[model samples]
Target: MSSTISDPASDGVVRAADGTPLKQRLNRALRREKLRSFLLILPLLAFIVLSFIMPIADMLFRSVENQIVEETIPLTVVALKEWDPASGEAPGEEVFAAFHADFVQAFKDKKHTRLGLRLNYDEPGMSGLFRKTGRPSTKMQPPYKEAFIKVDEDWGTVETWAVIKQASPAYTDGYFLNAVDAHRTAKGIEMVPENERIYLFLFGRTMFLSIVITMSCLLLGYPIAFLLASLPLRSSNMLMILVLLPFWTSLLVRTSAWKVLLQQQGVVNDFLVWIGLVNDADRLIMINNQFGTIVAMTHILLPFMILPLFSVMKTISPNYVRAAKSLGANDWTAFWKVYFPQSIPGIGAGAILVFILSIGYYITPELVGGTSGIFISNRIAYHISTSLNWGLAAALGTILLALVMLLFYVYDKIVGIDNVKLG
Candidate 1:
């Protein structure tokens, strides 16, 4: 027999050629793989942080920032610290003198417009009030309280000073309060007058419309998804082309097409006239209303609902339904009892996606939603562009972001995030 030799590597302690342990060599291999994977994803990670994360962080910071008053009226802010509006005492002569100097400087620097705009959010009409008073500020002399009151008797009241005092801080929740349709008063936070409380209504309408659109998409998409999943391969592929055709078209183009199709004198009304459905003189009011929003959004988002349901339904074995039917179960009973529960993951995924997208929609609503049907996102855009009230816009955006995150949290808890499938 040939001499048998024991290999040191096989006995118990394996080693690399240079005598390094095999365990260390394997760990080094794993480390290389981890580094390579991280390197491959670094660019995408950086992009997400810079584009999505940073902007949202900046908006959250801007929501609570309140520097307009402190910057414009530095001396007035300092002088008002000792004064108490709740004490029912007017600020003394020194406070008036300091305010006079600060207001004059602000006027000369052309910062009065910004100051007025900021204050007007807290106390309406302050913009015009400041613009009117700023022009005559130079004519006022010492014993300035009387002279300032002459510019506007409202200046002598404690209520006016209370607004100024509340706004003195460099950072505050005043914008958030305004976003919720409340005001900071001497007593504390209180709701604005009934006529002025519109933000809460807009928020409620946005959520309501979003739910309606999601439900509409579900109702229309379920049967189509089932048909697509159940049909023969060639037919399913052809139908899928139609379902995905909208993605090839521009969103603006689709919205504009709807506007043309739904207008009073457009194809829909003209067809109704031709069919003698009703008199041609009184065409239905469809576009630029809630009906238009619901219809357009349902069409645009229907594919999202269908794709998820189709992905889930395609994986479901037909044998389950066949087995149930062989056991004397009706088609409806088999589907409701056996098929629907398994398909719920798709429903949750699609509903959350559609609802979230609908809440933040601006261009669609702006294009077709008239004043009555406009969303809260439209209001955010108005404040951002037309009103130039970035603080309020940021506050509104932050609130909306919070709401979306809360929905995701709830969905994750109820359905388990792992169950969400988006093929």
Candidate 2:
């Protein structure tokens, strides 16, 4: 029997007396491992860029993008460049000729309506004026300022010229300004009329609701998490199922259930009536209001709080509390000093998660939230799909995203992100 002895370095790896080849091989191995790790994570990295980063970048870009007037009325854009706003008079004949030339072609190309709508953002009645003037623009001759005035005397005003000049820029801060309940005027940026300002109120309401929902979740989830963590494994597993059962249900289904339960004529009202807490004739207005949104959202997000708290609390040793008590501390004092502080990591994680989720929620608030409970997300959706005001929608979305990021920054500063415990 012929036996072959295997050599450790038989694969032709070279080695120097100083072990330089060994170090080179180790470096190569480390590089190979790093490459493998990068390859493994590449797909996830690409997915995040495409799905999250790209959309946010696009939305932020669109918020400041204003090319409608410049693109649709090229001649007018050029003409307005030299026409000074300080002149305090209507545009001159040369400016009118350039505008009339562009306006006629825009009318012929069926772009007048779009240009009109774009300009109308700066001045509300401009759309009607443009729409009415489209047909008559074809009939106008030279000295077009007089012709334009004949079509609509408002076009003769310096304010109309100012609006056109303001909108002619390819990029603008108007959308962002408008989003915060402010507008650009001849003087400078100023607040919108008090009656017309709703965005600030909407933002306030969204933050208020988000805070209330987060607090509600904390109050309800903390005790349950403590119970789950303190119980035996078998009992904890059973109780955990009860907490997680909501996760298995469809979100829409759960929200609809809340709708049914909270409706004026629904089970909750009937129960109140049966208990003589409320009369049948005076059912509570719970659904389609802020109360319904808060109740439904709190129920939906409670699990998020519970899971984090339970994870942290389960790892906490009972001996800490016992030791505190043996040292002359009461039950409440032991818990407050030893237990609750440890659980704060979980609280920070859960509160931030619930607050972030609640602030951006749409469907739950939409179905239950009548006019009063609607969030800024609802308005963003409205501008995106209904009004076709994409720039305005993007601005609103950017503002909300900024608010979330600001909250995250504040949380990080206060709680320290590294201290937040997920498990």
**What is the lDDT of every predicted structure here?**
0.89, 0.89
Give the per-residue lDDT of model 2 (tens digit) for 1-423: 112433245555555455456659788889999999999999999999999999999999999998888888898889888888888888899899998999899998999999888778778999999999999999999889999999999889998899999998889999999899999999999999999998889999999999999999999999999999999999999988998889667899999999999989899999999999998898899999899999999999999899888887888999999999999999999999999998998888789888988999999999999988899999999999998889989999999999899888877875676866532
- Candidate 1 lDDT tens digits, 1-423: 112433365556667777777779999999999999999999999999999999999999999999889999999999999998878978999999999999999999999878988989988878887888988898888999999889988889887888888899999999899999998888889999999898999999999999999999999988998999889989999999898898567889889999999999989999999999968889898999999998988888888889878887898888999999999999999999988887887788778878888999998889888887899999999999999999999999999999999888877875577876543
> In the order shown, what is each candidate's alpha-carbon RMSD?
3.2, 4.7
Candidate 1: segments with Cα more than 4 A from true spot: 1-13, 410-423
Count backbone clashes in candidate 1: 0
Return the TM-score for each candidate structure.
Answer: 0.93, 0.91
Best by the TM-score measure: 1
lDDT of 2: 0.89
lDDT of 1 at 272: 93
Total clashing residue pairs per candidate?
0, 0
